[model samples]
Target: MTEPVLTVTSLVKKFGRVTAVDGVSFELAPGASLGIVGESGSGKTTTARVLAGLEEPTSGEVAVAGEHVRGRSRRARLRRARRLQMIFQDPYGSFDPRLTVAESVAEPLRLHAPGPAADVRARVDALLDQVGLSRRAGDSRPGELSGGQRQRAAIARAIAVAPRVLVLDEAVAALDVSVQAQILALLDDLRRETGISYVFVSHDLAVVRHATETAVVMRHGRIVERGPTERLLREPAHPYTRLLIDSVPRPGWDLERLARDRRALDAL
Candidate 1:
């Protein structure tokens, strides 16, 4: 069996008296995608933050490529960042208003591996192209682009460093259905091309189903169900998971369909 690229053991995060993440644990093999699904305040984002090294865990262990993350020293933080990067939900705010797309993507590369300006420009252009952005788009600020364009730029920045794992916290929740599909496809393509792993956090089950092979359902700061994404969503064991799956709106799932199903079951 291939070793997991990312592992979380008994991870817990507390915000003073509030227990945001409670003893959550999971693993993702290299090139695999794992979805973390839950409603608001269910600790999905908190877990992603902990994994991304943005928020220090109150207690627990997060290991990347078999090496356990240590103290929050500068070196440790830098190491964690190089091993894993995060794409936050807010694409608009994630980038600086003044810096253009290329500048934003090149910022991390320069910080982590500074080199000649020409080399950085070359890498930035390559990354922009990889994310389906034109060289001209690289010169535009985040506000000048559409929402989907900004998001693609954000993805470019996240993958520019070639991190082993990506922690995506509601990464597509704000986009329209069409744009969301495009972004999801881009993410899968990136995984295939780079062999990178993902820890996808979202409340949207349909989006999760499209992006992940395996999934974990969280409710009130604890994992309630976990398994292959198809099986878990098709036959959710936990009541909370069932509620989440049912809450998603579907075509032909209106009063008429519900009544029809009720009548069919009654006749049976």
Candidate 2:
């Protein structure tokens, strides 16, 4: 059997007495996508941070392609980075204002392992094209691009190193719905072309439904329910999950009734 591309077990992170992430666990097979869905403070971003090696877990295990990754050593972090790259919620904030888009995209390539300038430019061009950006877009700065364009550039940069896994934390949250759909489609295409796995963290259930093969529902730092995205959304077993689902605005949802329903679910 093909081993999973990413595995996380008993993951926990704490800030003082508060547990930001509690016993979280999941797996991502090669070319698969997993969505972590929850409210603002439900630990979705915390888990993503731990997986991406930005934050050390208080206790737990995270492995990429069967290799354990944790610890603060420069070597350890770099080694982990070779297998995973992360895309953040704000593309503009992630990019260096002084660097042009092409330069920003090439930064990872040059940092990990420098190559000839021509080859680097070619890779940057290809990555830009792959993410639906034109060669001209590379000349522009992040500040000059639209939110969606900046995100495409961000995705290009994240994938330049050819990491096996990408951890996306609210990657499309700041975009318009149309732009969000475009980014999601770009992500799907990238996965198909590269055989990469994605750990997509988002609060948007509709986006998660369309983006992930499997989904995990988080509440107060713990996973309350998890399964295939469709099944879990269609028949949510946990009250929190149900509440989340119910919270989405539908065609004819009554606000007053929804408020009452939310109160009832919260009481449960």
Candidate 3:
């Protein structure tokens, strides 16, 4: 069997008295997509942060491409970053205001996938094109582009290093449905073409169903339910999972009832 590109074993994170993540565990197979779905404060973002080495875990283990991301030193974190990367929610904020999109993408190439200047330029151009951005888009700064455009550029930067895994924390939550669909398609295509695994963290179940093959649903920092994404959506075993599915706005969705349900669930 192929080794998993990413692994989490009993991961936990604490912020003073608050436990942001508790015993969260999952695995991402090579070229596979796994969703970590939850409501805000459910610890999905914290889990992603820990996996990407942005937040040190209070406890537990995370391994990316056979290496630990728990390494405390800057060199160890940077070395782990070469194997794993992240695309955060705010696209425009993720990049330097002073840098053009090309420069932003080129930074990783220069660091992790170092090559001659010409080769780096060529790679940046190819990455921009791969994400459906125009060559002219590369010349623009993050603030100069639309949200969707900036997101594509963020994705380009994240993938520029050819990392084995990507942890996307609400990567599409900031976009409209159309733009979200486009980004999701782009991610799917990239996974198929490059064999890159994904750890997609989001509160939106719709996005999870569309993007991931398997998922874990979190409530209050612990995984409440987990299984194939389709199955969980269809036959959720936990009350929290059922609540999440019912919370999605559909043709017949009743907002008042869902609000009540969520309140009751939260009280538990």
Candidate 4:
């Protein structure tokens, strides 16, 4: 069996008296896409933050490519940041309003890559093209672009460092259905081309079903169910998981069709 590219064991995080993430644990194999599904304030985003090293865990272990990363020094934390990149739900909020698109994407390469300034520009252009954005977009600022464009630029920045893992925290939740499909396809292509593992966090079960191979359902800071996406979506063991599955938007479900779909999916 191939070793996991990322691993979390007994991860816990607390914000004052509130327990944000309670003993959460999971693993992602190289190039694998694992979806985390939950409602707002269910600790999905918190878990992603912890995995991305944006938020330190109160007590737990996060290992990347066999290196255990716990509470390390500032320099060590920066090194770990290079290996794992994160794409936030709000692209505009995550980026600097003052920076142009090219500047934003090149920021990571500037900090991590040792090369001439001109080389960084070339790499930024390549990264923009890789994420399905035109090189002309390099001149535009986040405020000048559409929501989808800003999100695409954000994705470009996330992969600019050539990270081993990408933590997508509701990356597509802010986009229209059409744009969401495009972004999802782009991410899939990137994974195929670069072999980067993904930790996808979202509440949309349909989107999760379409994008991920494995699924973990979280509720109130605890994992309620986990397994192959198809299996869990079809026959959710937990009551909360069942509620989520039932909530998926389907056309003309009425009653009989819903049963048929559930039966067909369960057989998988």
Query: For every candidate structure, what is the RMSD over all alpha carbons to the true structure, in angstroms?
Result: 4.5, 1.3, 1.5, 4.6
The global C-alpha lDDT for each of the candidates, from Candidate 1 onward, is 0.90, 0.92, 0.90, 0.89
Instruction: Give the number of the best model, judged by TM-score.
Output: 2
Candidate 1 yields a Cα-based lDDT of 0.90
| lDDT tens per residue, model 4, 1-268 | 9999999999999999999999999999999999999999889999998887778899989999989876668877777878898998889998898989999998888888868989998999899999888877778989999888999999999999899999998899989989999999999999999999999999888889988999899887999889999999888887678766775767764676567665765565
Best by lDDT: 2
6-30 per-residue lDDT for model 3 (tens digits): 8899998999999999998888899
- The CA lDDT at 22 in model 3 is 93
How many clashes (backbone N, Cα, C below 3 Å) per candidate?
0, 0, 0, 0
Error of 2 at 263 (Å): 3.2
Which residues of candidate 2, in runs, are more than 4 Å off? 254-257
* Ranking of all predicted structures according to TM-score, beginning with the best and ending with the worst: 2, 3, 1, 4
Clashing pairs in 1: none
> Which has the higher TM-score value, candidate number 3 or candidate number 4?
3
Error of 1 at 134 (Å): 0.6
Tens-place lDDT per residue, model 1, 144-247, is 99888999999999898899999899899889889988999999999999999999999889889999999999877999899999999898887667656655
